[model samples]
Every structure is written in C-alpha cells, then in structure tokens.
Target: MSDTTSPARLVVLISGNGTNLQALLDACQDVSLAAQVVAVVSNRRDAYGLVRAQQAGVPTAYHPLKPYTDSGRTREDYDEDLAAIVSGFQPDLIVCAGWMQVLTPVFISRFADRLINLHPALPGLFPGTHAIERAFTAFQQGEIESSGAMVHFVVPAVDAGPVLDQIVVPILPHDQLDDFEERMHVHERILLVRAVQKWLTERASLPAV
Candidate 1:
C-alpha cells in the first residue's frame, strides 16, 4: 500500500487505442484522485497507449507474448515476465485499461489485491472480448434491452471478478452500434475514475498493518 499522505503509484496496461488509459492520465492531474500513473505497459508494441504515456512523460514498456509463443513457452512464462516488468514500477495499483490478454494466475497472484480491470459490459454478461458488439447484437435480437460497463478486481476468471463500480447504458430503439459504443465509452471513463477514487478512499481507511 502507498503512504496515505503520498500519491498512490499506478501501472496501467493497454492493448489498443487506450481511451481509458487517457482517462486515468487525465484524472491523475486532479489532486483529489491522489494517484500517479508511473508507468504504462502494452502487450503490443504498436498500442497507442504507449504513445499516450510518452506524451504524458510517463515511462512505457512493450512486453509482447509473441516471442513466448514462438519459443513454445507457456502462458505462465509470459505472465511471469510481464509480472517482472510491472513489479519494477512498484505500483500501488495496476489497471488493465484496454488490455486484451487473459492473465494467468501466476501474474494474478503476484499482484493479487492490487490488480483491476475495466470491462465494457455489466457484471456476469459478455465477459470476454467484443462485449460492445455482443451487447448491441443481443439488443437487436430482442434478448436484452441494455448493457453496462464496470471496473472490477482482475481475478483469473476473465471479467467475472468482484465489481467495484458499474453503470447501466440503455440501448435506444433507433441507436446504431457506433452511437451506442460512443455513449458507453463516455460512461466508462466516468465509472473508471470513480471506481479508482472509491478504492483509494477505502484503502486509506484501513488500519495500517
């Protein structure tokens, strides 16, 4: 845990455009958040999140899993190496903003209570990739009326971890996929920041070990 009087250190992981990563970067600028994104790591070298981190003057790392797969190494091996990279930052928290990979227990146990993720669906629904498209399709099929986004603890079970915060996003009758996606993203940014603030407040309230 970080000292209550100091800004909490954060390490963010991303795999793509990193709009959520940008949100965290922006939030950290506000003193009330009491956190600093010390590092950003991406599984793909081309992930624009790394560029965002660089623009913010935060350190960046690219830890791709291709070499591991090419060498016939296990997922655990890749996770172990990824954990090592993250450990170097000594983050008080690790946020998987847009990280696409399903982390193994090796990495999960290493960070354990400190790791969290932002998923583009309500808890227990559309648990994996393509959540937005899946939800929109479900709505079109008359199977569901709305979907949501959440920030949650990153357990080994995909996005099934305990949710910290969530918000329902209604699927309007005439909405297009892109329109719904954009609206959900706006809500997601707000929810992610709120969840981090809530987590930090709770952690600060705990009695010191």
Candidate 2:
C-alpha cells in the first residue's frame, strides 16, 4: 500500500497494442498525478504493450499460460505464480488494459480492491470478447441506440465488476464498424485515465498507513 505522500505504483497487463497503457504512461509524466507505472506484464510475449513499456523505460514481464498448462499445472497454480510476480512490484493498483485472459478467482482475491479493468463497452452490455463488433452488430439491427466504454473494478466474474467511470458513445447512422470501433477506443482511453486519476484522488484523502 502507498501513502498519500508517496506515488502509487501501477502494474499494467496487456494482450495487444497498449494504447490505454500508453495513455496512463503519458498521464504519469505529470508530477501532480501522484502515480508511477512500475511495470507492464503480458501473457503474450509478442504483445506490443511490452515494447511500449520498454520504450517508456518501465520494466516488462511475460507470463505465458500455455507453458504452464503443458506442464500439467492447474490454472490456480499458474495464477499463484503470476500473483507472486506481480506482488514483487508491490503495486498499489493493477490495470488490465487489453489482457484477454479471464483471471482466476485466486488471483482476483489476491489483489482484491486494487485490481481494475478497462472494457470497451458499456456495463452489462457486451461482457466478453468481440464487444465492439457485437455492439456494432446490434446497432446494425436497430437493437441498440448507443455503445460505450467503462473502467471498472475487477472481480472473479468476467466484466461483472462495479463500474468506476464510463463514457456513453453514441452510435451514428453513418458510422461504419471500423469507424465506430476507432471512436470507442478513443473513449476507452479517456475513461481509463479518468478512472485511474479518480482513484488516485480518492486515495490521497486517506490517512497515512
């Protein structure tokens, strides 16, 4: 845990291009933000997010799932090791930017209140993968009027966590799938930064440990 006097340490997890991670990294450059990204971890070694973290001079780690599975290790055991690696950073907060894996309950419980995720859809709308595409399909069928992005606390259940902040992105009639997805990414980045800053502000009000 970090006190108000010290900068909060962050560990970010990503599975793809880490645009949201980049946003947080940029935000940390402002000394007033009171947070620092200590490390970036990816389940995929090839994730571009690692490169971004490296370029930013932040530490990077990779913990692939297949190797563990191949060795007859249970998901729980793998997560335990993963938690240990993340805990080594002593993160005050952990953000899942584009991490595609559904975290096991053991890992979620270990981090508890410190874990969060940025999902590219409105809460309770599109919970799983292909969220943007699903939302676009719903729009094409006139099944929905709008789609959005959210930053929420991470729980054992996938995408069922309480939302911290969200931005409602309207679905325009002329919006194509690619265009709409690009717009949603913009909203995601903004909302993610907002939620993190909000957490920092709230945490700042707490008494020192």
Candidate 3:
C-alpha cells in the first residue's frame, strides 16, 4: 500500500493503441483519484501507447521479447527483465491494459496482488484475446444477449482471476461489429478507471504491515 498522503504510483503495460491507458492518464488529472501513472511499458516498439505516455510526459520503455528469443533466452527471461524494469518505478499497482503478452509466473508472482488487467468481456466469458469479437459472434448467433468488459486480478490463468469491476453491454437489434466494438471500448475505459480507484481504496483501507 502507498502512503495515504501520496498518490499511488501506477505502471501500465500496453501492446497497441492504449486507449485504456489514455483513460487512466486522463482520470489521474482529478486529484481525488489518489493515483498517478509513473511509467508506461510496451512490448512493441511501434505501440501507440508509448506515444501517449510521452505526450503525457510520463516515462516509457519498449521491452520486446524478440531480443530474448534471438539470444536463446526464454520467455521467462523476458518476463524477469520486464519485472526488473517495472520495479524501478516502484509502482503501487501494475495494470495490463491491452497488453497482449500472457505473463509467466516469473512476473506474476513478483507483483502478486498488485497486478490487474482489463479484459474486453465479462468474468468467465471470453477469457483470451479477441474477446470483443468473440462475444459479438456469440450474440449474433443468438447464444447471448449481451457482452461486457471487466478489470480483474492477473493470475496464471488468462483473464480468469477475480473480477474487480465489470459492465455489461447489450447487443442491440441492429448492431454492427465495429459499432459494438467502439461501444465496448468506451465502457472498458470507464470500467478500468473505476477498478483502479476501487483497488486504491481497498489498498488504502488495509492495515499497514
């Protein structure tokens, strides 16, 4: 837990555009959130999230897995190095916002309860990537009436950790995939911010060790 007098530091990881990361950065502008993003890390050098971080004047790092694989190192090695980089920021919370990599225990156990992720579907629904598209397909087939997004703890299982917050998005009678996806993104941004706030609140309430 962070000192109550200081805003909790966050290190966000992303792989793509990082709209969710943008949301977090935007929300942190409100002092009441009691959190600030200290750094943003991405596995892809081309990721726009790094640009977002730079625009916000937050430090950024690009840690790609290829360098490890190219040198006969394993994914665990990459994860270890990534963890080391994140540790330098001394983050109170680590957020995987659309970070495409499935973390190994090397990283997961290092952060333990301090890590969370945003998924495009509800808890126990779409567990892996492309969740929005999968959920939309399910809805189109009449197998489901709605899809949702959630922020949850990150464990070894992909997107199966306990949920912190979620919001269901109904599939309307005449919804296209693109439109539905756009709406889902909007809801996701809000849910992610709320989840971070909730986590910060809960952490603050915990008795200091």
Candidate 4:
C-alpha cells in the first residue's frame, strides 16, 4: 500500500551558507529518517555549505551555470548539463536551499514534482526572494498575526507549489529582521525535516498512485 517502494534519495542544491543543509545532515543521523542525502550541489565557489558538506563526509559539487559574460551557452543547454550532473546521483528528491539561480523551464520540467523548496515566509503570501523581510513588513502593516515557514513541491512559479506542511511562528511586537530571520531559520529547519518525514510516511501508506 505504499506510494514509493523504495527509500527516497536526496540531492540538495545550495548557494550560500547551508544552514538548512546542515539540518538535513543532522536529520539523516536519525535511524528512523527515511531519506538520505546522497549529493550536495552549489552554484558558488565560496558557499559555506561546500565546506560543511566536506566535513560531513558527503559528496559535493559546484555548478556555475549562469552569470557568464560570453560562455555562449543558452539557459536550456546550461540546465540540461546541470540536470545531468544532479541526475548522475540518481536522486528521488531534489531539495533547493538558498539556490539563488532561477531555473529554466527545461530544468523544471526535467525534475518536475520531485523537487522541493523551503521558504522563509508563510507562502501564498510572500512569493519571491527577501521573503523574511517582506513577512516582517507585512506584520508591521497590520496585515496579519504570526508569520512562519513552509515546505512545498517546487514549481516553475516562485514559492507557488502545493503545501506539504507549514508552521506559524508568533511575531513578537519588537522583533527585528535578524531576530525574525533567526526564528525563521529555526522553524524553517524544523518544518522541512517534519515535512520530509511526513511525505515519506504518506508515500509508504498510499494504496497506489
């Protein structure tokens, strides 16, 4: 009665200090965790996650597929190569954490539903980058109560995927951007781990597709 007959394999893509990537590493230490990250890819040569990944004894690679002056490579072609690199790991789930590049349509279609992202906003609210700042601003404008985190399937649209899980963090009246971001990071890590666990459980209990 399981949707997936096999354990999910993860390939995490990061472009900065991968705080979330570290969380996933810690989560994998749990014997009950159903997913194992087999690879970590970054777009920056100096991303802190590369060092962390190296220390953790996980495989890591860099894919600088954009911002070229005259590499003469089209987006589709660049994505095709990137896909090949990620696919080399034969991953079941591809997680993007602070991966700043906008993936081309070809890249998205290549991975499709198997991709997931962790956003710092309550999603359906803040759609693109700088979500934490936007969330705090929204709170300041009396737009809402508590703002929080979300984990969803990655779609072509920014942060517009189906919700896998979410947690609402109480916004303290005197919170700053850094404070909110710290809290956001905590909830973001917790929510993503919980979501992955839930997704695995759901997959294991399904009658069929």
TM-scores for candidates 1 onward, in order: 0.98, 0.97, 0.97, 0.91
Could you give candidate 1's per-residue lDDT for residues 61-89 as a string of tens digits? Answer: 99999999999999999999999999999
- The number of clashing residue pairs in each candidate reads 0, 0, 0, 0
Candidate 3 collision pairs: none
Compared with the true structure, all predictions reach lDDT values of 0.93, 0.91, 0.92, 0.84
Model 1, residue 160: what's the lDDT? 92
Measure candidate 1: CA RMSD. 0.9
lDDT of 3 by residue, 109-154 (tens): 9999999999999889979988989998999898999999989899
lDDT of 2: 0.91
Ordered list by TM-score, greatest first: 1, 3, 2, 4
TM-score, candidate number 1: 0.98
Tens digits of per-residue lDDT, candidate 4, 57-176, equal 889998886554267778788788889999999887888888887777788888877788888877688888898888888889999778898888887788888988899988898998
Residue 129, model 4, lDDT: 88
Prediction 4 global C-alpha lDDT: 0.84
Candidate 3 segments exceeding 4 Å error: none
TM-score of 3: 0.97
- Model 2 alpha-carbon drift over 4 Å, by segment: none
Q: How far is candidate 4 from the true structure (C-alpha RMSD, Å)?
A: 2.4
